[model samples]
Target: MSNVLNTFLDENLQDLRTQGLYNEIDPVEGANGPIIQVAGKQLINLSSNNYLGLATNDELKKIAQNTIETYGVGAGAVRTINGTLDLHVKLEQTLAKFKGTEAAISYQSGFNCNMAAISAVMDKNDAILSDALNHASIIDGCRLSKAKIIPFAHADMDDLRAKAKQATESGLYNKVMVITDGVFSMDGDIAKLPEIVEIAKEFDLITYVDDAHGSGVTGKGAGTVKHFGLQNEIDFQIGTLSKAIGVVGGYVAGKKNLIDWLKVRSRPFLFSTALPPGDVAAITRAVEIIMESTELHDKLWDNGDYLKKGLIELGFNIGDSETPITPCIIGDEKLTQQFSKRLIEEGVYAKSIVFPTVPKGTGRVRNMPTAAHTKEMLDDALAIYAKVGRELGVIQ
Candidate 1:
């Protein structure tokens, strides 16, 4: 390697280590469930995005196995070529019904879904008013569009309205769009979609919502857009099959014309290999499960509330989270990392999240309690938290 490249890597690596920002990944021994094994130690896992615990569901696993036997492992080619399989069609149809949209289109992953969908619609001739705390994928997508991005304070409806008025009335761009995450993942706060929709209507701005964290956790499992009954009002509804759906893929659900356009223009769909047939089949079934009943959804909320109440009672700062995601805020970076490390050592796998995932000095150990966590598990984890917190002087 070149000397300049080596120096750059070495300097940055040392800087991140000194600042406690370098994250060391731990490999889970088996399926990622309520109880996970890391380095041969059994731990109560609060770090997984498996909200409903469907990733390990027996029925979905069997379905995937059967489908793979029939369709083989890969999709063979890109969608525009010969990769579009019957399972893919079924998955999109199910997604459309699940999201309450006229049609839908699936992609390889949630991150690239935003990358493809945003740039496919908005361009240099347009401007987007994005929420300040939107996901990195959305931020990168906006940059890729070459559209003028104007950020509004996180969930500040008044600020969004003001920006919408300015961008739409300035007469500089051909179109204006407002985009936000349905639920802010870092703090777990639900976006003010109702207020945002009102502002979009006033300014005639196109509405886009990425409900990656809200689907199956809110709106009786439909999503945040449906949570507010704004399905008809919002133009674009984006979601991921990976998180709540417990599969691996992403999709955009909207009107038929939008779906039709994305099938042709979205670069990921046109270029990247399609999601595997078995995964597609399993994803279709997962959405059906979410739509059929709310048992898992209700249980997930119950677990979240139970864990949040326990953390708060023990004098931990879990920020204002409306969903099952609980973030234990620790302001100092080094202390936050220490808190997480101690928790892991004590047999609780709650990892630390710091800049640039979140702002500096606002480091947190984000917890995601799923439906699969029993009361006994939560009680055990809480006890461990109390011990760790006291030992670290984070609590009384």
Candidate 2:
């Protein structure tokens, strides 16, 4: 390795450590669920994205095991080659039904879905109006498209409308797309999809929604588009099988033409190997479960409410959150990281988010309450929270 490259890496890593921006990953010893084990200690985990607790579901596991037994583990080659498994086809079909779209195309991950689909449709001649609080993957996708990205205020319909009008009237591009997250992961706010759709129609803009955190949690588990009854109005609905679905993959559900185009034009699908048979089977089973009932969905919201109420009663400022995602805001970055570290020591595993992730000084310890958590577990976790909040001078 060159000395210059080594120095650059070493300097940046040292800076991250000194500034408290370096993330230390803790590995889970077993299956991820309502509770998890880390560093030989059991914790009431609030850091996982397993919103519905489906990641370790018995039924899903059995299906996956059976699939692995029958089909082997891997999908051999890329989708464009011999890797388009019958299971993959079924998974896409089931996802389409769950999303209430004409068709769907699958990708290796949610990040890949955005990276592949955005550039496949838009290019340098197009412009994209993105929400300021949009996910990093969406930002990366817009950049990959080589489109002129214009960021509007987070969920501000008026701002979006003005930008849409300006971008279209300028006659600067062949196409314009408006993109946002259905549910903002950090603040847990739901996007104004109905208003966005109305604005899109007025300006003839292509609407894209990355419903990663919304799927299997909102819209009776159909996501934000279906939550607002605008499934057909939105041009693109992107989702993840990893988050609420509790599996591993991503998808884009939309009109048949869009699906067909993505299938052919998306580089990841054409290049990367397809999802393993077991994962595909597991995802198919998971989507079917989400479609068949709302028991888990209701329980998830119940747990969320219970946790939020407990935290509020204890005087913790969990900012304005419309979903189960709760952020325990700690103003200073160093204090925020300390709070999270203290929580882990106290047997809760919520993580901290600070600068470069959220705006400076808005550091927070984010919590994700899931369906599998019992009232007893939440009660215990809340007791720990009160202890830590007082210890850190974050509460009375």
Candidate 3:
């Protein structure tokens, strides 16, 4: 090993410690949607991203088990090889029908979808216009594309339009693509897809919308593209099976030709192993549930509204969030972590998000109240929040 490696590692660790950004992981032993086991105690969970409360769903579990029995435990090769199983085919077709797209392609995870999709299409001679606050996977994907990434203000379509005009009119590259998250994870705000679609059409920009946070939460379960009623206009609509769908995988829904291109070109798809039979089957079942009933979706929105109202009434600054992802905004990083620790100690399981994830000063405990959370559960969690908030002087 290089002798200088120790110096570099130590310096980085020191910097993180100086900035109060060192992380300590917490282990959750069991889950029952709104509540989970942590540190040998049951706590009301408000930090899980399981929006539909489908992660431990019995129906999904049965479907997954059935698939495993039929197809065995794994797909042993990459999709480009013989690894693409009958279940994978079924999942893709189900996704296409669910999203109302011409076709769909599956990936191991949502992060890989971004990495695969961006690089599969754009390259060094191209330019990409991205939302300033896009997810880390998108950032990495854009860099991998070798495209010159120009960040427009987050959800500011006017700024995006300006950049699109310049990029297209200037004719400076082989292609120009505009990418954004359907729902911003941190602030929990939605993207202006209508405006983005309009700009894309006018400027002939390739449009990509990552719906990881929007897939099951919006569009009555279709996604943000449909929520804005722009399904036909958006070029690439990416979604996660993990968050709202309550499984593990990602997908790209778009025109047949576009998907066909990705199947052959995306490195992750061609290089990585296919998703396990169980995960794909469970996700397929989730799609069926969402398409057939709106009960879970309704309950989720209800819980979100209930939680948001309670938090606001307590006089804590909860940031502007249109979706179920709520953040109790506490400004200092150290204090935010302390608040989260206190919340856990008080029998609530919410996690703190500090600097780098959100802006430097806007540290917060991001609460994710799922549809599985009952009214009584929310009440208990709220009582704990009130007690903790006062004890820590976070609120008056």
Q: Which candidate is the best by TM-score?
A: 1
- Candidate RMSDs in order: 0.6, 0.9, 1.3
Instruction: Report the C-alpha lDDT of model 2 over 189-304, residue by residue, as the tens digit.
Output: 99999899899999999999999999999998889899999988999999999999999989999999999998899998899999999999999989989899999999999999
Per-candidate clash tally: 0, 0, 0
Give the runs in model 1 whose Cα sits over 4 Å from its true position.
none
For model 2, what is the alpha-carbon lDDT of residue 81? 88
| Order of quality (TM-score) | 1, 2, 3
Give the lowest summed-lDDT range of ten residues in model 3: 30-39
Q: Global CA lDDT of candidate 3, please?
A: 0.91
> Could you tell which candidate, 1 or 3, scores higher by TM-score?
1
Cα lDDT tens digits for candidate 1, 191-241? 988898889889999999999999999998999999999999999999999
Please report how far candidate 2 places residue 159 from its true position, in Å. 1.2
TM-score of each: 0.99, 0.98, 0.97
Better of 2 and 3 by TM-score: 2
lDDT ranking, best first: 1, 2, 3
